[model samples]
Target: MEFKWSVPLIILVLVNCDLYSTIGGSTLKNCYLCNTYEPSEPESRSYSSESSELVGILVLKIVHLTLNPNQPSQATAAKIRSCCGGPVSDHFQSDQFEKMFSNRSSLEVEDHEIENKGFLDYQSFITASAFYQPYGFGTTYINQDFFGTKEVAAFLAHVATKISCGNKVVTREQLSRDLCYNKEMNSDLSYCDEHYKNTYPCAPGVAYYDRGALPIYWNYNYGEAGKDLKVDLLNHPEYIEQNATLAFQVAIWRWMTPIKEHQPSAHEVFIGTWTPTKSDNLAKRVSGFGATMNVLYGDLICGHGDNESMKNIISHYLYYLDLMGIDREEAGPHEVLSCAKQVAFNPSISSSP
Candidate 1:
């Protein structure tokens, strides 16, 4: 399918509302999907701009996965950096954070002792780069074979549509429109927005803003990761487990760390306008499926034995989570393993122990 990659169709239906009306709720300001106006009580609700932006980055990574999954390892973060840039600090050169926090010779790292310190620091810096690079107006290239599967390409197209619309309100459209488009260079040429100067680059034409008209089909493709994630399922099931535990640890760390409170809320920074209240919902829903998929995929890749009983049980639990409307990306590895063992193993959680 060929996407036009043009301006999106945004439907903002606004009806007048009186603040004092109790019998009738205030006139609906924006379509729920379009998000044209403020909710009646904005304070009670929180939004996550960073999440939406991250979604875009994820989409890009998915595309790279289709082109060459291996390239996405660091390319995903690099694209984000190209589009956004990096943080600035008088005490440190924030752009070179990867090297800064890297485990290298003769380096005295300040935050080295933290749990999964390497991953968290890397993620934090990469995320920062994603937030800043979009405004850079230069072509962000990934390794030539960055895409891994067709599913990944389709995902990027889906996210492109989503970002074009106002689903999460990260707004890449405005940047695209305002910037001077140089196709050969794949760069935007525009002065940064004064208000966003300290952090985000303001590439007016090149930036994206409205994420409303994103098709429902994008959500439909959430299963690709599961389908493709089979390689890890069979062979390196442990990795799936590790990925889940790590994600859980990251979530826990975010909750416990004082730094999270000090940093701008995801919504405050980028586009997703609602607070992420359902992370646990995601954690719970994806636990079983991710592990199962990883094991299955691994088996597929490694030419292993077929276990019908294990498959049936894993499918049953995965179907249960599907009914709840959680996506595969949200599925963690540990949950997947536990669910697999529940069905795959009769007495013990492990095959032998």
Candidate 2:
């Protein structure tokens, strides 16, 4: 997407020159001199006109920096430097966000019997992203060039699939009906694991079925996410449903963090930062979108030979890539996008100890 400074934003900078001078520091060095200078008592009376002219010149300089993409203001550069992939606003704007989830937010969709209907919105997702952008939640650059658009699409694909309530179809329109549900429906299971009782005990009344954008299940999962986010989800797992920002934040945290020690995170696998070991290769796992599924869901939705669940996820990803103006072909061949034959990174327990 082309980056253009809006007139309102430019006018805001001009009006708040003092704020800019404080934050921009060396970048707006002369701005402070032009705006803050004062002469002795006798000369101060005569300095008004000259100071006003100097301030006008400073405004012109600031306007030039704002309008010229080649020369970003210091404040803008600082904001961009905070993210590994750069600011998401630069690549994914509000219009694209609306297009992606417009169906989910429609009145007809909201009328359906779904838990937390109409709960997921663009603002919540974008606001939550600010926290993890520094850790490359969406911003992942390969070189001087930005390569995070695909990565963002891949991550959102997972989110959309997990939370979607659309029909089980592989078409683009069907896949765009995402953000349908924030929490799992009609689930009575507590999903509490006894293994982590000592480390992460389940609360008496709370049931950790599935909640949040990616739907974190099990007591241990909630415990870990709560601890990291400092939200106390073990006691109040329902918090994920009540807060949209927290829901998306938990999802992004899961995407960026490794499930176990000495393991690759979903982010690492998808962005090609992870190298497959001898075991990973033997298990048919490679660093790509496929390995990301292996890293996150393991054998649950993988190693099942073209299963419906896995296919649905891949469809969402490819559809999102197209919607974001990224070619689906860039997602690679079927092998790089499928985890059908891959072994689970963390297999489910078949036999009790």
Candidate 3:
């Protein structure tokens, strides 16, 4: 899962030289990777004298933004600067983003090649998803807030995976086309189709709900309902603390399944909260959450007890996990058991109020 830097050399070389041209003049070149000014003489012999001079002579004193792998490249990078006022360079997979609407696995060979095409416009992608270009995904936060629901989390995860694997999730041409309704294929139709015939704008065949683009149904079952359930529960200030904790666990389990297999025992320890407060009782019943999970998976059914003992709440989640053929061993007995223990002690987040 190493994301080899796919930025074009032309872009990198240009940005590297100008980014620190002031102070290092005539003596040093700056490395964006190192964020340090180094003697110019060309760090390597392959570079031409001019290239080397560019690297050394004017390499220092360039204002630099923090550069890191997995982060978007500096806005002032050479590629972007060259394209100035034009479209900026994107480094994400375009095809994969398109494929997210379909339930196909992104592991196919074609998908791989598509992702590697490189350079993406994340803002357009976000816009396509019915959201304004966000600071990032989810609720525009860097942490769990960005992945609160299964759909959004899945989309973000898919994009990241696509980028890491060097695949394109969408195409520049596709971005230009109207992504919503298909005007050419209007021969047949049903009531629901004709009723809501307005093409889904950015997400291709899906409309935005609230301010965000609609998510294609992936696992089936709860789709929007599951997301809504969590939203309703967490909105209450009293229930916010405990519900946030549980929501995060649910998201981690859903988002990391293909890669991590199952989270380790440490996850429970890292996420478990102190006992819930009396106000936490105001939260919605677990039935909605459970029912949502059951819908997504189909084979599993979840039941909630109102004002039930903490013991049953612990068993409740475990029961569904077991039904899904997931066991404590996969999640690690220690982690699963720890979560169960927390559930047992918590007064809120139970079946009953």
Instruction: Choose the strongest candidate by lDDT.
Output: 2
TM-score for all models, in order of appearance:
0.16, 0.74, 0.20
* Regions of candidate 3 where Cα sits further than 4 Å from its true position: 1-92, 98-125, 134-139, 142-151, 155-353
Model 2, span 43-135: residue lDDT tens: 111113212122222233333233222433556654442225334555787678777776776666634676565677665676666545445
List the lowest-lDDT window of 10 residues for candidate 1: 9-18
Better of 2 and 3 by lDDT: 2
Q: Which scores greater on TM-score, model 1 or model 2?
A: 2
- Winner by TM-score: 2
Sort all candidates by lDDT, best to worst. 2, 3, 1
Candidate 2 lDDT for residue 117: 58
Backbone clashes counted, model 1: 77
The local distance difference test score of each candidate is 0.23, 0.68, 0.25
Model 2, residue 1: what's the lDDT?
Answer: 29
